[model samples]
Target: MQGAQRNSLRLLQWMMAASLALPIALFVFASTISYTSTNDIADREIERTLDVAHEHALKVFETIDRSLAEINEVVRGLPDDAIRAREPALHQRLKRLTDSLPQLKSAWIFDADGRSLVNSLVSPPPEQGFADRDYFLAHVDHSIGTFIGTPLTPRPPYQGARFFGVSRRRDSDDGRFIGVIQASVLPEYFESFYARIGSDPGSFFAIGRTDGTVLAHFPRLDRDLRLDPTGPVGQKIAAHPDHGLMTIDWASDGIERRIGYRRVAEYPIYVSAGLETSAIRARWYATIGQHLVFGVPATALLFLLLAFAFRRTQHLQAEAAARREAEEALKHSQRLEALGQLTGGVAHDFNNLLTVIRASVDLLNRPQLTEERRQRYVTAIADAVARAAKLTSQLLAFARRQTLKPEVFDVGERIRSLHDMLATLLGSAIEIAIRLPAEPCLVNADAGQFETALINMATNARDAMQGKGRITFAVQVATTVPDTLTHLVGSHGFVSVAVSDTGIGIPAARLGRIFEPFFTTKQVGHGTGLGLSQVFGFARQSGGEVTVMSEVGQGSTFSLYLPRVPPDLLPQRQAPNTAPALAGSGMSVLVVEDNIELANFAADGLTELGYSITLVDNATDALAELVVDADRFDVVFSDVVMPGMTGLDLAHAIGDRGIGVPVVLTTGYSEALAQEGRLGFELVQKPYSIEELSQVLYRAARLRRVRDGAAE
Candidate 1:
């Protein structure tokens, strides 16, 4: 009887073990299958999305290209001047054609110089020129058929609207390039369609130029983005050319995805679509979670297993949260450290300059100072002040806050002009090589800043080479900027001035931080570390960018990209206005500045310049004076930033109240000035020399008189 009871107990135990083991095995197998199936589904969906995006992009481009062709035919054999002369009829005709196409926002006819000969948007096209525009530049030298350009915000009165250009090159009877017939395609049209088809939040669709310029994206990116040709998707496209598939972490947003891409026929355009990896994994989890409900039979056992899983999930989520917090803290600390470094560097340099000025001032004030000694002290003081100003200027450049004076100039010529100077600076040990295109590479930018940027790059290269390596400067027209500099690339093209050095290369670890202000690898006092920062800022401020490539032993190359100016537009380059700082000719001026010292300084300077000055410390007080006798002051010179009413407000109020005094505004730095620009008022930046102030005042007073004379 005891043996039978023992046998029964063993059988029951075996059955219980079998029950748990069988279900656990089934759950594992089911989960594996579900995960694999989910991935397969995701892959199929991505390919489908890619097909849809590809087809949609192709149709849109084909339609627009057809419309562009029709417009091109109409304007065929007609010179830009003739089209400009017949703008009225041509504009209406272009408008009708553009209106018929849902994908098009507008159409434009540009001369070889990028002048908007006529556009469908407005009558007379707002008197604006597009000589520096990318689409115009692209079609200028190259005869790429049905060229598609990246998205760009249209200039006011359509400022807030975004459009991409589809342009065809126009040629004269002699086969010389004349201009372009471009259709302004609305990117929103494509984006909206993509959103409708790919509604999943993880779904991404994009249309880009083969060269990597993003024309449109489904998940509307806040800023322009580009795909790196070196990245997985770009490589896939390069390999397949027509169609390809890959799983990659997209460089643009750092999202891992199962993606597919296709080229739009023979055009230089590509369409891509993808589903996020995380989303696919989530779908798999949900599927397996459902399967878990049926896999477990015993309620108590299932409850316990779920509880364990729930705890594990909670622990994992907590760990992820902690990691995220740690990362945020690290980033915040890094930012603070960078701030400290920048401030310390600036303070150190400024203090040194201040020390020189202070010592010079003390010596100048000394009793019985010799005439020669006094002059020497004054010169020292002046030199220190100048150095201080230069330091401030460099800081502003790195911050991209300095006002720029941009002009059109041939970059090739400028480099040629700087050859002797650069050779001298680099020393005889360094061999300098200049490589330029046969044609001139013209760009519109601050020539001084451009020169400074080049000098900074050369100086950096010299240091890397230990002042004894070959430095080659090359200038060429670039169709696309590097992916890192996508934001700065123009839709038309860029003029790349690459400075290459055969020297010890920058390490990968420090490459990204090279542009940070005051960040350097040099020994103490060797480098201020603002050279690369200045180059970065100047490039960005000039609507371009700087990119670097390096390998440990191979050396480094730094490329500064500036938007190209068409050679045909060279004649339109405005000559430097060197207005003589003549006497103000007794013109009455109303000066408005809150700072007492600045107000007095301006008053003294203007008085010396033969202007009768009425000084008011605030805009309100200045307004009160202006209201009393609007015609008494020939011009109102006011600082933009002040207590109570701002200079901008005061100027508006004066204009609203019919004050005749022409308002000239000034500021050290104001966001309003930086963003909205002069707002139709003449603006003079602060720290202006007396000569500059005099010239501005004289110009203002003379302009007011001319207006008054015309009114009379």
Candidate 2:
């Protein structure tokens, strides 16, 4: 009788376990179906909304362009004087034309010189000229088809209107460029329409020129907003200029979105529509939540049954916990692997540079070397030093940790000066073109790093073109940085230096990783892959950004945007100094460095430059020496990183103790210097030439003397 009872209990326990498993398995199956179907429905809805936006953009732009074409034909053979003679009639005609089209805010006719001849907004249009405007300049230079320019606020007398130019080039009978005929397309029209159709929460709609300039957007961004050409939406347009779909984290609002984009047919414009991923996920959650409501009660009942078989349930729960822990450990291991890969690449390149230097040194040690042989070894060593210095600078720039010395200067002048240098760098096979606006574009940044960034980009262009295509450098003024550059969205304005190449374009798949350090597509030994990385870091560090646009077979354009400084901020230009190279005469320098070899090298170099040098191993010893006879040294030249208190600390200590000597800090790399900057002291970067060292020391020493003389 007891054995029978035991068998019955075992059967009941098995029945309970089966029941628990059955409900959980059914719940999992139901959830999988619900989640998949929910995502599908969301995707379809997003695509449907995108289709509507695309069609709306097409109709609006087509209507505007068609009207402009009709106006072009009306004044086809009329000269500027003839158009002016009939100004009243022409203005009335334009006003009527604009009134007929809800898309157009106004219309204007400009002469060859861009003087407003007739406008729909006002009769005998205001005495304003648009000669400097992008739309006018674009048509004046070339006979491109319909051109849609970036958004701009109308000047006085029409300042209330917000419009972008939709222009067509006017040509005379002889094909000479006459002037521009432009329609002032109201962005508000597009915005209103977008809002009506884009009713979903977190939906986005944008109309932009092919060049990534935002002409209009829904949810209304600043009028000056632009799009990053290297971002996901831009890449989609580049890869599929006609139409495409993409999933990306939208930088404008920091939302992940599923987007669809289409180009306005035969026009330099594109339109995009997107739905937020978060919103889509919410729908999925809602659908799944409904299932959970029913499944939860069933699950609770199953748990109660499992309590009768608590031993089996405990074993399963422990296994699940172990699985979770293993997953976490694996994720940590993967992160370490990624770190190791980056470090390994850095180590490899550094080792190669070091090997070259080591080999050159070993060869130079041979006794009684011939002049030719000795010169070759010395040249090799010099080459290695230069390459190493460049490598170090690139690394620092990529990390955005380089100490920058910023000054307000004209970027156009700098580019003009680099013509000869760029010519030499790109070689004879490549043709170079430069386009500079009449007005100077100025920015405050480290001029040397600016030049380096330009050179790096040009070099990349040259390589992409296989050393034989035209590279154009164009400088333009921009009112706002791209909104997709999340970090720089609120920047007041920017000056864009664009480098374009007629070379093999970058692949869309590769564009996202192009700025990562040591990520390269070039064959081994052909490139270091840090060129773009350096450009990226330098722009960000300088309060700006760099963006790229590339179509697989149609070449590429890389643009560097820097914070613009007004012309008023430019420092007065001083006459060039004609002083002799030995300019450090009579200045005494206290060299503070922990490394004996480096200290001796600097001391000897400064001494050769006509400066008297006193050497010390650390800041403490240098302070001791300075405390003894403060007037003995004109300047203290110190290495920033040292064994004890850093060089920066010493500079502070010197100032705190009333040491009148000026401190000039030097370093190859220092986190503190990069973060806090020069700290009111002169700074010279490492691997600097003797001439550079002399100039900095002399300037600091002379400044000190002048201050001391004033006190006396």
Clashes of each: 3, 0
TM-score leader: 1
User: Cα lDDT of model 2 overall?
Assistant: 0.84
Task: Give one digit per residue, the lDDT tens place, for model 1 in 1-712.
Answer: 3465456545555555666777778788888888888888888888888887888887888888888888888889886678778899998998898788888888998887777888887877766678777778887786888777778988766754698888889888888898888888888888889889988869888888888988888678878888788876677777888887788887678888887888889888888888888988989888887776666546457556655655565566567668879988999999898889988998888888899999999898899999999999889987887777766667778888866767789898899989999999999999999998998788988788899899999999999999898999999998768776677555557899999999999999999999988888898678788889999988877878899999998899999988887677672354354555679778999999888998999999889889999998888889899778887889999999997899999999999998888999988767666556577888787677777888887888899889989999
* lDDT by residue for model 2 (1-712), tens: 3465456556667767777777778878887887788768777877788788778888888888888898899999998889888999999999999999888988989988888999998888877888988878989887998888878887766776688888999999999999999998888888888899988777888888877788878778764776788877677777877887788876666678877787777777778887787877787778878877887787777767666566554565567668768987997996687567568767777788889889988988999988898899889888888888888898899888888878788999999999999999999999999999898788889887899999999999999999999999999887556875656544347899999999999999999988988788788778777899999999988988999999988999999999887776774453343334555676888999999988888888878778898999998999999899999898899999999889999999999999889999999888898878898998888887777778778888888878878989
lDDT of 1: 0.83
TM-score against truth, every candidate = 0.53, 0.51
Q: Which residue segments of model 1 deviate by more than 4 Å?
A: 1-321, 484-491, 571-580, 655-658
**Candidate 1: lDDT of 445?**
87
